[model samples]
Target: MSVVLLALSASLLFLPGLVIGLAAGLRGWLLAAGAPVLTYGMTGVLGPLAPALGLRWSPWVLLGGTALFALALAVIRGRLAEPERVWTRSKHLVVAGSVTLAAGVGVGLLFFASKGFSAIPQFWDAIFHGNAVRFIADSGDSAPSGLNVIAQPAAQNYFYPNGYHLLVATVHQFGAGTVVQALNAMNALLIGVFALSMTALLRTLRVRAAIVAVAAVLCCAFTGFPYDLLTWGPLYPYATGVALLPAALALVVRALDAPRPALVAVTALALVGLTAIHPSVSIAAAVFGLGLLAQRWLTARRVPPGELLTLALLAAGALALGIAHVLGTLSAAGGPAYDWAVQRGVPEALGRLVFFTRSFDEPQWWLILPFVIGVLAFRRLLPLLWLLVASLGFGLLSVGAAAYEGPWVALLTAPWWNDEWRLAALYLLAVVPVTALGLVTVLDLVRRPLPRRIGLVAAALSVLLFGYLSNGLYHQRNGNRLAITFGGGPTVTELEQQAMNHLAGLVRPGEIVFNDAQDGSPWMWALTGVRPAFGHALAGTEGDGLGKERPLLRERFHAYDTDPEVRAAAKALGVRFVFIGQGFVTGSQKRAPGLVELDKVRSLRVVYQNPDAKIYQLTEPDGQRPADQPGKTPPGGPVVVSSSPVKPKPTSSTPS
Candidate 1:
C-alpha cells in the first residue's frame, strides 16, 4: 500500500517530463528519463514567479505550468509528431533490465531506510528541511526569499537550493498520509532518478546495454552516497540535487550534439534545474559541459557555432532571472558560520575520495579502483580524466585557507565544493560510468572461454566485496550489528512526540516558544507549528536591523523566571512560553550560569510536565508586569535598559 502511494506520487512528479518527452518525441525510457531535471528546473523558476503573481506553489500550479510549457512546445513545433527510435530486441531488453534493477534497489532501499520518517527526522538538518516543507505546505509560500522565517522574517536560504524541499512540500500537499511519508516517498523517487539518470546518460554516451544495467545497480550499491548520507546529517537536499544532475547533464550533451530549438530549450531548463536543485550540481555541470566541448573541439577540429550561440542565449536568460539570488549566495560565502578551522591535508582529501577514514560505513577503495583503471584504459575517456582533475582540484582547494581560498577561488567552489564530501557525489557521477566500462573491459578480456553469465556474476561479486570490505554491509542499530537494516539513525521517541502534541494544543499558531537546544527545538517546529526562539540555525538572529534584540531575548530567556527586565524583554519579543525538555541540562551548559538561574527562578508557573519534558507559561492576566521586588536585584543589580534599537547582522547560511 505504501509502495503504491509512493508510485503515484512519483508519477505526479514525472508529469512535467511526460509532457516534455511527448512534445520532444522521445520514446521508451528516454521519454520520462528527463523528468527529474525538467521538474527541478521548472520548480526553481516557478518559486520566484509564484509569489510575484500572488499564488502560492501547489500541485495544481505545477500542473498548469507544465500544461502551458507543453502548449508552448506544441505551438513551436506546429504538430505532435513522434520521432523514430530504432533499437534491437536485445537493446530493448537491456534498457528494461537496467530500469528494473534501478527501481528495485533504489526504491527498495529508500523504503526500508526511511520507515520511521513519518514521525520525525532522526538526523540534524531534518529539522530545517522538514519544517521548510511544512511551512510551504501550510502557507503555500515556496518563494526562495523569506525561507528562514523561523528565525528572521527577512532571512532566505539562497545559499541552499529549495528545489528538493519544494518538491517534498508538493508531495505532502497531495499525498494521502503524513509529511514524513511524503518525504520518504520523495526520497525513493529521487533514488530512482539517480539510478535511471545514470543509465539514461550511459545510453546517451552509447555504452552497451549490459554495462548500462550494471551501472544502474552500481548507482544504488555505493554506500558512500545515496545511502550513507541518508543517516549522516540526513543530507536529503544534496542527495536529491545530485540525483537530478546526471539527467540535466545528459540533456545538455544531447542538445549540444544535435541543435534543435526544442532540444536547446530543454537543455536550458535542465541547467536551470540543476542550479535550482543545488549550486554544486550547477558547478559540476559547467565543468562537464566545458570538458565535453574541449573533447569535441579536439576531435572534430571545429566549433559548432549554432550550438554555442544557443547555449549562450539560454545562459544569459537564466542568469538575468536568478542574478539576485546568485549574488546573495556569493556574498554569504566564507561567513563565520561556514568557516572550518580543521586543516585537511592532501592525504586526508584523498582519503575522502575513497571514503577511507571517513566513517565506519564509508566505501572501500575497490569500488573506485576499477573506475580509475577504466579511465586510464580508454583514450576516448581522456576528457573525463580532465573533468575528474577539475573536480578534485576544486575539492582539494576547498579544504584549506591558502592563497587559493581567495575570492577568485571561492567563485569556483562556493556552496558546492565548500566541503570535500559534497564533491564525492559529483565524483560518483563520473565514477559510475567509468566503473561500468571497466567491468565491461574485464569481461571482454575473458570472453573467449568464460560464459557471459559467469562474467555478470563476477561483476556482482566484486560490488558485494566492495561493500563488505568497506564495513558498510552492516550497520549498528540499538548497539547491535544488523544486516539488511532499512536505514541508519535513531527513531523519534514516542515520549517526545506526546509532549510535543500536548504543547502544540496549548500554544496558538505562530506563537514564540523558548526551547533549549539540547531538547531538539531546532527541528520540532515542523511538527508543532510553533516558532523556536533560538536553535543552531537561528544562532544570533543578529540581522534585519534588530541585532541587539537577539541578545536581549537570549538574556531574557535564561533569566525570565527571576529578572523583571528579562520578562520585559520577553514581552517585547513576543515570547509566551518556555519549554525545558529532558536533555536541557545534560550538555556542556549543565553548570552554566543561565541554567542555574533558570532552575532557581520562581515566577515561571509550570503549565505541563511529563517524564520527557516540561512547559512553563510566562504570561499573566491583563498583561501587566509583576511588581519589582526590593531584593530582586542580584549582586550586580538591575540591567541597564537602552533606548536605541541595535541593528543586527543577518544570520549566515553556511553549514556549521
Candidate 2:
C-alpha cells in the first residue's frame, strides 16, 4: 500500500508538472522545477473543491482527481505546438537525476534519524496534528466549520490551518500505512521537492551552473535550519509550507522577468499552495510578490495587467478561504497562549545571525566569516539580502525583549510568529539562499590562474567544514538512547501504548471518555476515534472563548460525579466511560481530588483494570443504568472490580 501510494503520489507530482512544463515551454532544469509547483497548485485547488463537490477528502479521491486533471492537461498539450526538446540532451537527464538522487539521500537519512515511520510523530504537536489529519480523513470534510470535532470549544476548527491535514489525510486514505507514516512519506517527497526548487530558483536568478550546484549543496546539506523543522516540529504543515516557498518564489521570479500569462497563473497557484500549509509563508509570499510586481512596474513604467490581475485574484481567494482562521486568531489576540521570555539582547540576537538552535549535532562556525564576506561581494542579490534582514528582525521580535515589547509586539507577532522556535523556520528560508549565494560568490573569486589551486583548496576546506556542520549522523546514531524525550523523542512507552490500545478496544467510537486532561487524553481521537474530556491546557483545545466545551472539560477534571454540573456536562458531552492512570498525569494532575471522590460515587462501576490504567463505566445519575449490567450495588460505595485483560461488548447507539 505504501509503494502504491508512493508511485501514485509521484505521478500526481510529476505528471501535472510535466504537462505544465510542456505547456509553458520550460527547458532543461526549469522543466524539472516547474513540476512541484504544478503538483502543489493542483492539490491546493483540490482541497477546497473536494468538499464542495460532495467528494470524500481521502488520498484515493485526491489521487483520482489529480490523475484525471493530469490526463486532461496531457490532452490539451497534444493540441498545442510541437513540444520543445525537454531533455535537450542526455546531460540534462543526468543533472536532473543526480540532483534528485542527492535529495533522496538527504530525505532517507532524515527518515532513519527520526526512527522508522509510525502512526504518530513523537512531537508534542503531533497530539493535535495527527488527530486533525484523522478527523479530516475520516469525516471526508475539510471545511472550516467541520473541524474541531475532537476537542472542546469547537471554534478552534476555524483557527488551525487545514492545508497540511488535507494533504496528509488525502494521502493516508490512498496509502497502505498509518496516518503518521503517510505524513512521513509526504515530508520526504516535499523535502526533495524543496531541494529541486532551490536549484531552480538559483537557475532562474541566472546563477552559473557550477555556482547553482554549489548553492544546491549548501541548501540540502544544512541539517540545522530546514531539517531542524522536521525534528523540532516535527512541524508537518509549516515544514511543507516552507518547502514550497522556494518553488513558488522561483516561479514568481520567472514571471517578473517575462510576465507571461501562464507564468502568472503558475505563480498565483503556487502561492495558494503555500497559503494552505502555512499562512506566515503566504504572508511572506504576498510581500515578495507585491515588491517584485512593483519593481517590474517601476522599471517598465507600466503595470503588467495580466500579472497584476493574477496576483489580485490569488490575494482575494486566499483571504476569502482563510477568513475564518484569521478572524479566529484576531478574536483571541490578547497575547500569546504561553509565556515566551526574552532569551537574549541585541548582542545575542546578532550572534544568532549565523548560529542555529536545535542542530546541537552540527555547528557551522567555519562558514560565518565567508558568509559575511560573500554578502558584501554579492550586492546584486538584493532581494535575498532584504529577506534575510526581515526574517532576522522577526526572529528578534519573537524573543519578547523588554525594549521590543509594546503594542507592536502583539500586533506583529500574534498567533503564528509569537514563538521564537517557529520563527526559526522563516530564518532558514532567508539564510539558506544568502549563505549559498555568498559561498558561491566567494568560490568565483579564485577562478583566476595563479589562485586556482588556492581556490580549489578553499572550496575543499569549505565543503569539509560545511559537511561537518550539516551532518546528522551523530543524531541518527543516538536516536533511541533517550528514555523519554521531546521534539520527536519517545513520548509513549510500550506499557502506555498497550494501555491506550486496551482502552480503545473497550470504548466505542464517537463515545466520550472522561480521562485526565494532561495525559493520553489528547491523543484518544487520533488513536481510536474516541473523544477525551481534555488534554493539556497550554496545548489549547479547551478552556477558551471558543465554545461551551471548555467548561465541560473543566467539570470533567474537577467536578465530583454526584455534582449535577458534572452529570449535566457529561450527559451533554455524551461521555460513557472514564479512563484513569498515570498516563493522565503530567507535570501535575489538578483533578486528583475529584478522581478520589469519583471512586466513592455509587453510580460508577469499574469495568476494566490493569496495573498502569483503569476504565470505569458511568451509570445514569437518574438510576437508569445500562441494560447489559446487573444492578448489584445500590447508592453506596461504587462496585470496584479488578480483572485481567478483558473486552466489553458494544452498548446502545451513541451520537458521534
Task: Tell me, by lDDT, which candidate is best.
Answer: 1
**TM-score per candidate, in order?**
0.82, 0.79
Mind giving the per-residue lDDT tens digits that candidate 2 earns over 575-616?
A: 777776543323332454456556666666676556556677
Instruction: Give me the overall lDDT of model 2.
Output: 0.57
What lDDT score goes with residue 131 in model 1? 76
After superposition, the stretches of candidate 1 with alpha carbons farther than 4 Å from their true spots are: 78-86, 154-160, 320-337, 355-357, 361-366, 380-389, 394-412, 450-492, 535-548, 561-565, 583-597, 620-656
Clash pairs, model 1 backbone = 41-273, 113-486, 113-487, 542-648, 542-649, 543-649, 547-648
Residue 85 lDDT in model 2? Answer: 30
Scanning candidate 2 in windows of ten residues, the lowest lDDT window is: 647-656
In order, candidate lDDTs are 0.60, 0.57
